[model samples]
Target: MKLGIVITHTDPETVFNTLRLALYSLRQGDSIRIFLSGKGVDIDKIEDPQFDVKGQAQEVLDAGGEFLACGTCLQLRKSGGSQICPISTLKDHYEVVRDSDKLITV
Candidate 1:
């Protein structure tokens, strides 16, 4: 299955759980694309002591799940993006939604 996850917030637990799910899905032989929108573009900056968002995100990447960030959102925050949040476009977002076998939002 091809999965697309649209994350629009910086909530640590939520992002952590979402990446956990992505990692599980990837382990199940599913392809996943995570698109970071709005505050989600700050994924690499999450500092929650309990959730370990960055570590989970890295696990997702290592498990073959891809991450993309809204370029405009990153620009609005004066960010140049990061390894887990590379700059992406609306077109990439659209294609993720349009092509995925399943689409999830959080």
Candidate 2:
């Protein structure tokens, strides 16, 4: 199944839990995609003095789950640098949502 998980919350724990669940789905052989928006874009930024949540996000990426940060959200957050994850337009997210067999939001 194709699963798309959209996370808009800024809390680290919420993002972590969302990715953990997505990771579980990926490990089970499901195609998974993660869309991080709003303050959730912070979850994609990688820098020194990193937290466990950042590490978890990296693990999700390393495990081959599709990770996309909303483009407009990134712009609003002014997080336009190498620190953030790949920026995805709202159009892209809409397509993912449309194609997904299951859609989840956090």
Candidate of highest lDDT: 1
- Please write out the lDDT profile of model 1 over residues 11-92, one tens digit for every residue: 8999899999999999999999999999889989999999999999999998888999999999999999988999999999
Positional deviation of residue 20's Cα in model 1 after best superposition, in angstroms: 0.5
Itemize residue pairs with steric clashes in candidate 1. none
Model 1, residue 13: C-alpha shift (Å): 0.9
- Kindly list the per-residue Cα lDDT of model 2 for residues 41-103, writing each as its tens digit: 777553434346777776777778887888888888787723336888888788889999999
Provide the TM-score for each candidate, comma-separated: 0.98, 0.85
Clashes of each: 0, 0
Which residue pairs in model 2 clash with each other? Answer: none
The segments of candidate 2 whose C-alpha lies over 4 angstroms from its true place after superposition are 45-51, 81-84
Number of clashes found in candidate 1: 0
Model 2 error, position 68 (Å): 1.0
Measured by TM-score, the strongest candidate is 1
